[model samples]
Target: MILIDADACPVKTEITEVAIRRNIQAIFVAGSYLRVADHPLIRFFAAGDAFDAADDAIAEVARPGTVTITADILLAQRVIEKGGAALDPRGREFTPASIGDVVATRDLMHELRPGLEGQTGGQGGGPKPYAKADRANFKNALDRVLTRIARG
Candidate 1:
């Protein structure tokens, strides 16, 4: 199963296409209603407008056989703790060996965010614009991870 943190995700179209083609069960969780594909394997979940509500919803169902797509390191850590796999939208897979460092770095960045906010002078701030290459990378990574899980 593929659990997606749908809000602010850039590769939703690609994810939907790949899930349908692979006949995978993909549950898209968001803060509110989202128009999802009309298919048996494609599902949509509205987690409400509370903080981390969507992440909480996704984590609740995360398990050994599930793969969650999220960019939030904290949510990814929670999913990993539950023995599920987590992948960033940019195609980076969070693993047991790497999650620790990833979390620490994320925390450090958060701590430094206040100081760095105005220092950039409107340059080098926030995530880069999603590109075609990023979409392709995400599709490839999703396929590879799903194939690995299927094999197991």
Candidate 2:
């Protein structure tokens, strides 16, 4: 199963395309109803209006061997803890060996954001814009992960 944190996800179409081609199941968890392609392999779960509700829903369903897609570092950590592989939209896979440093860096950035904002007069840079290259990388990463799982 490929579990996706759908809110703000840029690669939904890419994921669904891959899932369809690979004959894999994909569940997209979101805070509200989102239009998804009508396909038997694709499922959508509405997690309701609550902070981290979608994340909680995903955590509950993801198990070992499942692939989770998310940009949230904390949610990725949780999935990794459950033995699931976590990949960001940019195709960066989070693993046990790297999650700690990623989490710490994220925390440090969060802590510094306020101070930086104050110093910079509320100007803050957001994540880089998604690009076609990112989509290609995500497709390749998903295919590689699925192939490895199938081999085992």
Candidate 3:
């Protein structure tokens, strides 16, 4: 299973394709701004109005061994605490014990680099570079996780 923060996600289509190919169930949690697809394996849940409503929804639904896609350092930490795996669209994975350090470092970066506003998704930057290498890397990671699930 997978939970995706669809509102500001960049690899929505790519993730959907990969999930479909793998026959995995993925629920995309979004706010009112995102228009998500309706599929058997992939569903969308609208959290109405709230800043971290989508995050709450995904965190509530995600379980151990499930993959969560989100760029929010805070939210990823929450998922990690719940024993789920969190991944950024850039393919960075966050674990339960490491989330605290990651969040602390991210906050420190914000303090040190005040003017540096990071951009992962959304229209604030140009189109994301979806290289073939990225696709291959994601595929490999996806397969590795699936293999682990199978092993267990």
Candidate 4:
């Protein structure tokens, strides 16, 4: 199963296209974003109105090798530690070995965010143009996840 953390998610359309091409199931899970479409292959779940509830739900039900598309490093850590694949749409891969330091830096930055209220560094390195190269990379990553799950 391909699980998406849909709150502030980029690449939904890209993921949908890939899922269609691969003939697999893709579920977009959200907490309160109620504007998602209703599609046969692409399922949408509104877990709750609370923050991060969708993340918790996805983490709870995800098996040993599910693919979770999320930008949150914290959630990625949980899923990856459970033997799953956590992918950022921008192509960052999270794992147990690196999650600790990453999370610490992320949290520290969050704590010190108030100091950068006027810093013009505005959220760089987001999902790029979903180019052919990105599609190829994403396809390979999805294939790796599927292969690992199949082996288990």
Please name the candidate that would achieve the greatest TM-score relative to the true structure: 2
Question: What lDDT score goes with residue 45 in model 4?
Answer: 84
Better of 2 and 4 by lDDT: 2
Worst 10 residues of 4 by lDDT: 119-128
Cα deviation at 145, candidate 3, in Å, is 2.3
TM-score of each: 0.92, 0.93, 0.80, 0.75
- Residue-level lDDT tens digits of model 4 in 39-150: 6778888889887799898888676657898888888887877777788776566767888898998877666554346654344453356576775676677666666766
lDDT of each: 0.91, 0.91, 0.76, 0.76
lDDT of 3 by residue, 34-89 (tens): 66557788778888678789988888877787888888888888888887778877
- Global Cα lDDT for candidate 4: 0.76
Give the alpha carbon lDDT tens digit for every residue of 57-139 in model 2.
99997778899999999999999898888999999989899999999998777766655535522345988888899899999
CA-only RMSD, every prediction: 2.8, 2.3, 4.4, 3.8
- Model 2 misplaced regions, further than 4 Å: 115-123
Which stretches of candidate 1 lie above 4 Å from their native place? 115-124
Give per-residue lDDT, candidate 4, residue 148. Answer: 71
Clashing residue pair totals per candidate (backbone < 3 A)? 0, 0, 0, 0
Query: For model 4, which pairs clash?
Result: none
Better structure of 2 and 3 per TM-score: 2
Per-residue lDDT value at 139 in model 2: 92
Residue 138 of candidate 2: its Cα lDDT? 90
CA lDDT for candidate 2: 0.91
